[model samples]
Target: METHTELVEGEIDLKYSLAERVKTLTPSSTLAITAKAKELKASGIDVIGLGAGEPDYNTPENILKAAAESMEAGFTKYTPAGGLPELKNAIIAKLERDQKLTYKPSEIMVGVGAKHVLYTLFQVILNPSDEVIIPIPYWVSYPEQVKLAGGTPVFIEGTKEQEYKVTAEQIRSAITEKTRALIINSPSNPTGMIYSEEELKQIADVCKEADIWVISDEIYEKLVYNNAKHVSIAQLSDDAKERTLIINGVSKSHSMTGWRIGYIAGDETIVKAMTDLASHSTSNPVTTSQYAAIEAYNGPQDAVEEMRRAFESRLKEIYPKVAAIPGFNVLRPQGAFYLLPEVREAAEKTGYTSVDDFAQALLEEANVAVIPGSGFGSPDTIRLSYATSLDLIEKAVKRIDEFVKTKWQD
Candidate 1:
């Protein structure tokens, strides 16, 4: 046997080498920021993390009870690769009840999470170099997942002036022979913007004419606030329903992020392809999570509404305060739990050249964590999640205000 130094110096080291595909992938910026904050907290630093996308609320009690009962009854065995029948029925009921959209059992398939569902969908739909239209600023995962499926992400800008929503004309302009799909994340992550019903109708018309598939990510649907309503593009018309894939889960609404259950509802052929791919990749969403999701969908939704109220109250309370920060330009978000504030002026005033550098300094100096917007394709902005408690949100914002004021004065 060789000594450690000989082993290092002598032979080929294939074990540590990454696959080319893996090398090209970027780790999630949201997760990276959260992890660093966690590391600092572990090392006895006082870090207030506003970077995580998960609700600070615990998984609802009824859902937990359902999962516990499932385990006790030996429902711990392997389930169908797509999902349990009971859970699928619950999802079907949810669609008809909430969106007035109908989906057959064959048109729905469950996956480990919305992220996994999206990955599987991309895998089944994309060919190498096929282009998928994505609007900026997008969820960090959209472009990366498209690339992972050997698809190119063609981005159309949704400027702040447009409320961060790309128009139908923008979508029409991006389509080409290679265009295969377009992703729309309403009540979007990082931005909290929702496209109106009329906007969806026009966008759906463009997709229908251009023969492009629409991937509607409505994960934050339940979290809409004020007068905003989340209208599924799939509900626009029969033609739109035929062309749209709906991705959703209990993660946001039921606070079940760790439960790992999400699903896709779409055309039968595409759903079958996703199910078949899931059969190989994740086997099935965790059996317990499936059962819990059944209860989450079928159970009384008071808890869901309660959490929504809390988020809405917090959003109303904080938006004005955040916007009032000197040099920070933040629009009042209509839905979701995040605020995407353009901080380029703030950064410059604080003597930083970029928002990324300012975010780094914020973490080091003020011990507050926010995701820099470069990861979301908007380099002038930063994302701050309000999913945490209103108290923490207030404290974090105060720290930010003081930090910016002090730096600007210096």
Candidate 2:
């Protein structure tokens, strides 16, 4: 047996060490850059942040009132681990009304947020060494969550010319016997691109033929612009619905990022497994937040439309200005409040070797914070969220434009 002193020293060493599963995980680059921007602002610096992937608007008044009413009625105790029955019914109704898809309460599992819902999903469905197909330039959490679940993430690149959306052929080529699931995030983060219905149907056929699960992340379903429509892969056919897990929340749609409400709609067996796991883990989603989400689903949708229009207007104003910058190639985004601009040539012209170095220089020199695309599996581009005011967007883009011109030309 080890001596007491030796055991105490071992414990001390282990205190600073993390689990093997999380040791290789990368921190979220978007959150990191946003934190740095906030830190700089706290120090009295003029930092223009375009990094956070959240709406600047507050949660709608009706939702807030619902939460307050629920609390006043003393409905604050823990509900079912999956979620409250009322909220599940609301989710089912919302899906049926919006997507023409029907789901029972047993087919839905609600968690802390969409992130938590996805994490729980991977935990229940993934076995060790199983592979999950993910597209490049994906959300920062997808790969990390797969790794945390003891699964490998296989990535296929989606080139800029394709609007950063991958094709079914690429997915077909990447599949193998070990493949367990494929993630499809329409209105994708870091890219703001949506896959069309035809494209989704093609992808769904491949998934069905290969016996793989389709994880459809539609968190930004309500944010499409330019008359673009958002279609769920689950809506393709009954077989597609049977094989797809629809993950969505009110965070982006209702401007309720802090409300901690998201749910997964999928097969009853898988949802039951996730609920059982949550029973031992989170116990339940926040009680008050669940009520707020119910109101968000059933209340007037004018606030949602208002926020969508505001984002669309901002996109129109900023897209041209950013695209006009020298050596920058920007794709006009069809959905979501983000702009991913390829800045490789601009970085080179400004004497930087890579976009990562260029991003750091711009933040330090111009006090403008944007996420380097290296973390999103694209090192040649950068992501800017236009969730702020139009004035801020203009000022930040102008500063970026001036920074490039002054360094390269003058």
- Report lDDT (Cα) of residue 309, candidate 2: 99
Extract clashing residue pairs from model 2.
Answer: none
Q: Write one digit per residue (lDDT tens) for candidate 1, span 72-188.
A: 999998898999999999999999999998888999999999999999999999999999999999998999999989999999999999999999999998899999999999999
- Candidate 1: count the clashes: 0
lDDT of 2 by residue, 315-343 (tens): 99999999999989999999999999999
Residue 54's lDDT in candidate 2: 93
Q: Estimate each model's TM-score.
A: 0.96, 0.96
Least lDDT summed over 10 consecutive residues: which range in candidate 1? Answer: 2-11
lDDT of 2 at 86: 96
